[model samples]
Target: MKDNIIDARGRACPEPVLLTKKGVEASPNGVKVLVDNVTARENIKRFAKNSGYEVKVEENGEGILLTLSR
Candidate 1:
């Protein structure tokens, strides 16, 4: 299935991860989370892993893109 994208740049700590988690949970397929910080990227990855979703990450310029799939 296709995925959705969420731009979470400039957001702090749990906000980025929490928002990403919510997006993934609400999606019918999966979500792609975009963040500008390493912490946000790691946190989102951990959240996906903990929630049992497949995750992939890519670094684009100064941002991180996280793909979450079931």
Candidate 2:
């Protein structure tokens, strides 16, 4: 089930959000955004929500996963 994961770990601010935007635009189905920090998680979550997508957060040894779906 893991697919199109945008790894934004160690990235700051707009970078994560920009990557997410590009991912979303590229994939109409949805995407999984992976972030290491809470700030990145929150920013990506907000960006996903504003783009009219549902956000599901998951924590794992790898990092924080922000799953975005239509």
- Residue 51's lDDT within candidate 1 is 86
How well is each residue in 1-70 modelled by candidate 1, as lDDT tens digits? 5657889999999899878878977894689998998888888888888888898899988588988888
TM-scores, all models, native as reference: 0.88, 0.93
Error of 2 at 34 (Å): 0.7
Q: What TM-score, to 2 decimals, does candidate 2 have?
A: 0.93
Q: Name the lDDT of candidate 1.
A: 0.86
Candidate 2 lDDT tens digits, 1-64 = 3399989998989899999999988996699998999999888888888889999999999999
Task: Give me the runs in candidate 2 sitting further than 4 Å from their true place.
Answer: none
Taking the candidates one at a time, how many backbone clashes does each contain?
A: 0, 0
